[model samples]
Target: MDPLERLSSPAPEFLDRLAASTRALHWLVALPVLLLLLTGLTNFWPELKALHVGGARVFAWLHVLIGLGFAVALVPSVIAILMRRAARRDARELLAFGLDDYLWLQHRVLRAAGLRSVGPRVGKFNAGQKLNAVLSAAATAALMGTGVVLGVNYWSKDVFDVDLVGAVFRWHTVLSVLLLPLIAGHLYMALLNPGTRESLRGVTTGRVRRSWAERHHGAWADRVREERRAGEG
Candidate 1:
């Protein structure tokens, strides 16, 4: 039997724990962004002028602190990703894809728009998830770049022109706005999608239905069964 096959078959408990951890991390990251956005709006919206400058300063400081917290969370997130990569490499299923996965993507999109007759069978992550991952990485990089520029502008206005800083700020705001919709979609999919909802349960309880594993990750499920059989043999 292939070593990859052995590794791909995650125990139900293991998959559950991993999903829960990932979701918790997501919420951890989102809370700070929400707070930062609220504080940011006070600075940007004149209608919010009732807010005192002192309060604004406090919010600004809080935003920076929260941003720092967000960065810190990346440490654990990076470690998890590395672990996942190792697991996938050993299992030969990192970003695993097949005809069913692609068909699932098409079906999901059609179903979303009320056009598909039947839903497609998805794998661990759907096409939308892959797209979200790419977008998130890009957004995080942009946010970091813009944040540095804005932070430095306070001391070296000449070196980092006020106009340039302003432009970066706009980009930062736009990116943040764009993320809002994506995040909402992600949440809905996780919480509302029947197939995905069970997978999400692993986040909180660290366990999923055996049936779910078989339906969504058939290949992975088979690998696990094979491993178990080999071990028994």
Candidate 2:
């Protein structure tokens, strides 16, 4: 089937699924990351820094506030998943990776470039998306840790020597720069790519069109079918 045809709603036999907690957490996490990027850019570029008086100082404090929000934002999703049985199951489905995911990555890249669909059956989270999630989580943790350290130095002089804090700041800055490409690619896939646009609804509404799920995540579609059949039986 043409991928575009599947953009519309699919039959009930096709599953529409994503945890409500997952949907909420995505937006929660996105806010601070975007704020950090915006403020960091102003501080990073001298010309931009010079454009507004006290902008750097103002954003520095704002970054700290958002940084704290970033840290807090991660906790509720994890807690909700662990506490809710359905969410726990969904988390497992998202985290599990096997042979199909590896093959999907190999072909999906080519398919995205206009080649034929020669990929293996993919799950709800494709290999690329899974990798993106893992990397993004790790980067967020690192940013939070480094940001805290930097914030400490800014407010108090006695916690650690200036040199140690400077080194940590450098690492934080480097990680922030490295994250740009991943963020850019994520935006392209989530917003710009026509084929994947429907997937965005999963985050916004806790479900995507069943057709898009099946077309992009065939293996996951199969699993959902099995679960539904088992439940009925």
Candidate 3:
């Protein structure tokens, strides 16, 4: 088979499975986050609190329930990353930001504005994606931490400082609000941007057009191709 043909073919079989697993994990985490946000937002805006009868009570109960699910959903993914060597390796790469990523972001910004035709070769996750992942993870951690404080205040006695719990709630709300735009941008890129929409296949079908991978994630594609060749040999 020609190299170009290989370049446009479906990703390696293992990658498809990995993508599918991680995608499921991602949705597991994302769903509860969405639920918590919707329920929690009503509590944040006083006027909106009256939108539904007993809305305050409903939102409070739903928020805590959803927050529990959100925290629990994170555990399986963490366990998977720890148990799977490949996942750990990939996670490391994803977390490591370097000079190439900086260049990629610069090019990406210019390209997005229609000012440039090309940019640096991106890896599996582009710079923006990496940064978004980091920020989202941070937000999740903060929410989880503050959520525990809120949970304690609700279930237990006033052993801890009431003022401290209040402070935690404020930070939690602020972090939640900050994450909204980041999540929105991620969704828009994955679902709307023509150039990036195909990447969503990684999460959906655990496969994507080789051409899409080559064009958008050139560095990763090159690594994939090399690995394929090595395996064939």
Candidate 4:
């Protein structure tokens, strides 16, 4: 029997546990991103120049701290991903897709521009989410790489050249700018879309309504049911 099937017919305790774990991790990821953005802005804008020197220094320290935190968070995230991968071996839900997911993506775009009537049905993850995850991961790596170079240069110039450090800083800035729009889009989707907003409740509460799971993860729900029945019989 599959664990997901058991989840579909979740005991109250199981649901509670799932909700709490999911919510904790989601907020853990979100808070730092928000802080990093606020601090980064104060560090960058000229109109906010008065805050730049002090703000940038503070932000730089904070960013590095948050980056280290992210690295720590990745340990658990990676473990979860591995466990999920083992469970879903071939299904690969995170990378899964079908006609519905594509249509949903199209519907979202049209709706965003006030051109669509109905949204598309999505499975465990829509195409947009997959894209966002990939982009965010790449951007994070780039930011961390550039940060390391800059930090090394700042603390010990003899380890690397001034020119190289400058170049890395430029790369970090460019990647950060590229990440801004995607982050904004992610926030808007999470906050503005009714379905997404409800889904996001799981981030804070740790457990989403059963209906939300049925609607957004129908296939997963189906699998969970199958697994449970198999386990019972």
Give TM per candidate. 0.67, 0.84, 0.83, 0.68
All-Cα superposition RMSD per candidate: 7.7, 3.3, 4.6, 6.9
Candidate 2, position 211, lDDT: 65
Residues 188-212, model 4: lDDT tens digits = 8778876577556555565565555
**Which pairs in model 4 have colliding backbones?**
2-227, 4-224, 5-224, 19-206, 19-207
What C-alpha lDDT, on a 0 to 100 scale, does residue 131 get in candidate 3? 94
Best by the TM-score measure? 2
Q: What does candidate 2's lDDT look like per residue over 1-233, in tens digits?
A: 35446454344333557777666556767877988888887876776555544544666777777776667666765686568776676667667778887888878678879888777777668888887877887887898889888877777889988899989989998889888888989989789788887777777777766666777877777888898899999
Error of 4 at 24 (Å): 5.9
Candidate 3 per-residue C-alpha lDDT over 142-198 given as tens digits, one digit per residue, 9 for 90 to 100 = 989899778767666576798888898799889988999988898898899877787
lDDT on C-alpha atoms for all candidate structures: 0.62, 0.76, 0.75, 0.65
Candidate 3 clash pair list = none
Give me the displacement of residue 123 in model 3, in angstroms. Answer: 1.5
lDDT of 1 by residue, 30-58 (tens): 66666766766666666553544654455
Cα misplacement distance, residue 14 of candidate 2 (Å): 7.2
Which 10-residue window in model 4 sums to the lowest lDDT? 12-21
lDDT of 1: 0.62
